[model samples]
Target chain A: MAEIVLEGITKRYPDGALAVQDFNLTIADGEFVILVGPSGCGKSTTLNMIAGLEDITEGTLRIDGQVVNDRAPKDRDIAMVFQSYALYPHMNVRDNMGFALRLAKADKAVINAKVEEAARILDLTQHLDRKPANLSGGQRQRVAMGRAIVRDPKAFLMDEPLSNLDAKLRVQMRTQIAALQRRLGTTTVYVTHDQVEAMTLGDRVVVMRGGVVQQVGTPQELYDEPVNLFVAGFIGSPGMNFLAATLEQGSLRTSLGDLPLEDRVRRRLEGRDVPRDLIVGIRPEDFEDAALVDERHTGHTCSATVDVRESVGSDVYVHFTEEGGPAGTAELAELAADSGRADTGMQGHRIVARLSPATRAAEGSPLDLWLDASRIHVFDPATGINLTHPER
Target chain B: MMSHRNRTLTGWGVVNVLVVLYALFPVWWIVALSFKDPSTLSDGNFVPRKWTWENYHGIFQTSEFTRALINSIGIAVIATTIAVVLGTMAAYAVARLRFPGKRLLIGMSLLIAMFPPISLVSPLFNIERVLGIFDTWVGLIIPYMTFSLPLAIYTLSAFFREIPWDLEKAAKVDGATPWQAFRLVIAPLAAPGVFTTGILVFIFCWNDFLFAISLTSTTAARTVPAAIAFFTGSSQFQQPTGSIAAAAVVITVPIVIFVLLFQRRIVAGLTAGAVKG
Candidate 1:
């Protein structure tokens, strides 16, 4: 119902540590925007600043085109669903949902009717009279949502609302939240560290790292054209594989093999100061079993010893080790540390390739893999910037 | 052979009986003393040989005992109410706020709680007299509040810490003002702790004999415990044991009633549903 505009919003703590710096984002009316990053990336702090729970040390916050830097959370007309649910323990589900209306001094009948409608929408009608202690985790989550829905506020701010639920329930509730937002058409700003939630639930996703935004684009755009090494490694499952490579003449000299650059990449690198030492990025799905590849499609091919083969019903993922060392850079090291794989002392550069189910690749066996050279991304070792997609 | 579980049960049963006997024996003696006739008061029997309501009747007939009882109730009630209100605010600030002297405030309260009351009795006596509040309800109530405020703050702050901080933010986001959030959301959730603290403060104020006797000399502000020491018989040569026992029983009834009324609420885990485990 309203567009939330955060213009250079910054949050600097009293200890002089900057939690968020110059954050700027204009959430369009009825658009679902997700702020996603690893832990300590200031995603929640940014959301809190918008909710007025945290003071913005710099810049102005505008809601519906009015500056509300000093307005309280209640005066801002925004509803938030916390990660902990935070349902009032003393009140029953009905009263918890109708609290805002009651606080506004609405008529009793109107409060009851609106609460009933929200309960119906959330499928919590049977639990309206039950205390929060009596309901299941999913039911409590619904009550949290119903509390926000009954207000029909200017926007909804959700901070990892599904994190408390189990994995299966999280997926189920994620779909429900997406559908609910679409049906209500209410502007929502969701903050989460789970990139999958960011990919699936948002019209546009903002990938952040170290309190700075890396990229903001649609899910497909982010997946296909990540602007930096962090976003490329963070966006997709099984993450993009980073390999140490060197660019010389018109090809990339990698540990797997020398890969001839595609015409488009060669054209993009025509007049730029291309670094000799580069980090080559390739998504797992971009690799194929050479035997299953189309005959007419010409692509780079490499032979690797398959260390592990996993069959997940529809496709097979083959993990292997290359002779080259890991593509070590500050950004990739941070990404590895964030994923808890930093000190693993991995033997060699690990590579994962998604292959067709029909391919007969076995563990400890040699297999020929085809790489889609045109989909490959090259990053500068010094700056972590995706050299091929720098304009994105 | 007896089963191990049966033996354990029997052992616990014996221990429970012994504990109950150890706790209730003195209370039984007091009740028996209150019911004894003045002529048989010195018999020292566990049970009263000739039971009578004479001691109760005698104490009630005198306005001195009745006035002292009224004063005890009023002072304890007022002190507990004021102390709890102030303590709840201070505890909330201690639990939630980040101020400069927060640690110092907590330390000071703890220090006051541990301070010996007898050492301050003479100083308080002089201060109260100079302030023109000596021998009055305000004098006793002030000391009672000052001592019990630390107990209230410590107990209530522990309870406040158990409550999730997100609830307050949720309340604000739900369109409640700061005062409304504390009143409606935080206070209700903190009721068990508040009630428990109130009971403790009341009992502390009720049973305090040192201050009660040292601060007040006349019937105007004398509480039951203080007045009990001044009780006399019909003759100066006779002792007032039966009357004193009766007054003690009368004062003990309110404490028992308070515990019985709030026992369930004090034990209830009210924060169960506030957040996920």
Candidate 2:
């Protein structure tokens, strides 16, 4: 097994196009690290650089403490599962899996044993004689994995290997892959645009934007403490809502109301000389129906007029207008800076709140809202970076 | 409804009949002439008074026809083989490799194909003289590649490109070298294109008459086309008609037989990935 380390790794095209920059990460042996980003956000480019498919423009890449900057993919002792699976159309499943071993000139018995092992792991024993074209999408994906597995490579480089599968199959394969990787304990670097997959599969996830590393941490860490507005908006399902708020004396003020700071949060913001205006991050689930807001967290409650209500069986989400945040904040850019929020003192125009299933909040109703202030994330409106705990 | 449909069917029937006649008339005439006696051939009618195999027997008895037949087959096979191999490599590179002038290389190869063989025959003749192979099979094979290479590469390259890159990458991860990956993954996928190219190149090489006649002056190196000219030579035939028709039948028979035997390969995917065949 290999512990892959990328130090200041960057890729720049001949036309001065930057695909990835200063990408530093150390994936431990047996760890599954995921590179997550939107399309063209350099996740694939980074994966390709690691796979030796693309040439790196700067920095060093090491596998197991050996600098592999000039090494070929084969010499790197790595196996890659391509997004397309890349199964040989003419070869049967067994031959496909055995291709690498056979290329290594392993004994026939060894090849057969390993091929059968990989096939059994993938539950592909019965289909060993079938060609790739005859296989289903999931089967093809398994064969790709099996091809990588049979090699017993130092690490597994998966380039969105499940992107081609249908939704339900993708989830099923996703878990199966994670379980398989856990069993094998091989170092794996999986690249994908799906945040859910990254969150669920990666031991430590790296969030990227514009070819730059945004944050690298556990999914929970990113979700609870996003370093910037980009990570805050990017990590969660519905994403954290950003509203312009004032860093008043011992409290933050929005058009909705003054949310009194909790002890822990107050301590984080106490010594910092933050600008008067700031971008406050509140997760959708942190906002509950104000009518249902218990006295325990009433200090953080704000009143809002509901606009849209969606019932999703287990929970209800209410989109509403608040009285004290930025007025008509639509673009992500307007909330990126403290100074640019022209209507910061007017009202928070739009808000999405997750209410308890028992509480019903209808459109046109002016309902009191409560925040789980202990979970409230404060970011600088100017830079979109969280300012409440700037040190960390 | 039955009557209207019957009328439509009859119209199609007439059109098909006209097309079939247009296609088969010349072939039927050739075959009929081949069976004709010298007297009947000179009479110049559709049907022969009597059939004879004497003209066919004459072709076997003569050394000129036998030598030309072997020479033609040898030249066609060699040219087709060379064309297929070179074309496949060129096509694979253009299809998959990311070299600086990849597109330009493909474009130039195809652009050079637009130069007619007849136009290049004189220059090739000079080259042939320099190489001391003016009347040999090598000379014909060399010039024939100029015609068939472009088509072969064009056919096989597109097919190679159509194969997903995943298989090759999978091969690489499987520990196969790039060359091995190509052999194991790309070759099989490109088989149909190679087969199609072989058949087409063979047909073109076999039917080539211009360079064959102009370059090769002797019976030892002359192809069937040039050899057949002897049957109609001024001094040889009394009327020069029946023997020429007989030689024509000899020439057409092998091509028909070869096409029928391997019709599947040519038809299965000759223009499978072609935008317009």
Candidate 3:
């Protein structure tokens, strides 16, 4: 119910390490914004600064058009749901939910009514008398949510609230949180390292890297058009496949084959001092089984040996090894290290294609994959900039 | 293999029985001696041939023993309350705050905990006498609280560190001021630690002997253990063994009862119930 604006926010530790620098964003009233990044990317730090749990070393944070740089967390009128649930172990569910109201010196009857309503909404009516230690993880998570809901604060801040739940329970609570936020129409800023959660829960996503904002856009916008190499690799599951390519006259030379650039891409490259060395970004969904694609629509095709095949009920993922070196860039290496994929440094890169379940691509056998040429993104290798970015 | 397992179980059973016997034999002998008739007191048998309540009645009737008992209870209670309150605050700060000389403070307390109490007796005796606080409850309570504060701080800090400090942040975000967060969230979580520390401090204050006898010249502030050393029989040449035995059994009853009632909570406090495990 409040519009939060961060202007040139910066956080510097005493050791001269910048945890978050020049972070600026304006979350519209009732908008759900997610700050997504890898570990140590400062998304949580930024959220902590907003929540007033951490001090803003620089810049002003305004809520509802009023600068709250010196305001304490309690004075800011915000509610935060911690990843660990952070429920009062000594208090039962009812008291946990009613803690804020009690602190605000609200009437006892009013507190009871609000807590009861929240319990009903969170399906925790039966657990009102149980201590947090006695409840299951999901129940404890709901109590954390109930605590926020009962307060009806100006804004909601969640730090990986569902990260501690089991996989199935996490999915269930994810939808519940999204629906609850929509119903309440409260401004929320959520932080998570999971891209899937960010893409699904956020109205707009802010991708951060090394204490800097990488891109700010909607999920589909980021998926379709990442501004650089890190966003391209970090935004999707089995992330976007990257390969080294060279820009040549009228065509692009890649390990797969020589393919003509799309008309829009070629136009952007014309009359520009673009670098010869480029990186090609292709999402898994951009590739399909050649057999399933119509001949007229198969504008581009690549042949590689399938290393593994996994069927996930709705679709099949064909993992393959193309005859090319992995895209060597500081961006990709940083992304790899962030994902902990850089542990075994000797292994070559993997390229995964999300093919239709009808695909018969077998392991250790050659598979022809149809590529959507228009969907591929081309980036300048030196600067990690998207050479064919639509806005540029 | 079956016989080997049987032999191992028997070996452990024997060791456990020996341990129980070793710990309880002295206590049982004191209780038996308390009940022995004065005529049969010289017989050093494990069991009394004839039992009587005369020694218990004799001690209870004497103003010296009664006054000392009152002093012991009052001094230990006051000392424990003060030490635990101060220790809780100090421990919380040590666990959660950042201040200079924190390590030095911890190291000094530890050094005090390991220091020999007898070494300070001579100095404390002269100081208390000059200060005119000797032969008073304040004299005994001061030393008890000072000596027990280190144990309180160490045990309570370990417990405080185990608490999920994020709950405090959550409280603040939930519209609580810093004081409210501590009173409602932090204090409740720390109750077990404080309670355990109180019992330990009380035990230390209650059982103190060197400073108690050395600092006090009369029954005005002498505790049970110190007063027992001064017990006298009805006649000038008679032994005070029966009365001493009776007082020892009487003093041990409260401690044993306290341990029995709070054994589970004390163990859990020591182990720290911070995480789910």
Query: What digit string (tens of lDDT, one per residue) describes model 1 on residues A73-155?
Result: 99999999999999999999999999999999999999999999999999999999999999999999999999999999999
DockQ scores for all predicted structures? 0.89, 0.39, 0.48
**Model 3 pairs in collision:** none
Ranking by DockQ: 1, 3, 2
lDDT of 2 by residue, B128-164 (tens): 8898999988888887887788888888887887777
Top-down lDDT ranking: 1, 3, 2
Candidate 3 residue lDDT tens string, B28-146: 99999999998899898999999899999999998989999999999999999999999989999999998999999999999999999999998998999899999999998898999
lDDT score of residue A2 within candidate 1: 98
Give the interface RMSD of candidate 1: 0.7
lDDT of 3 by residue, A18-110 (tens): 999999999999999999999999999999999999999999999988999999999999999998888887788899899899989999999
C-alpha RMSD of candidate 3: 2.0
Tell me, by DockQ, which candidate is best: 1
Error of 2 at A9 (Å): 1.0
Query: Which regions in candidate 2 have their CA more than 4 angstroms from the true location?
Result: A296-298, A321-350, B1-13, B42-51, B100-107, B232-237, B257-263, B266-277
Q: For each model in turn, which proportion of the native inter-chain contacts is also found?
A: 0.88, 0.48, 0.57
What is the alpha-carbon lDDT for the whole of candidate 3?
0.89
Task: Classify candidate 3 by CAPRI docking class.
Answer: acceptable
After superposition, the stretches of candidate 3 with alpha carbons farther than 4 Å from their true spots are A270-272, A295-298, A343-346, B268-277
Interface DockQ of candidate 2: 0.39
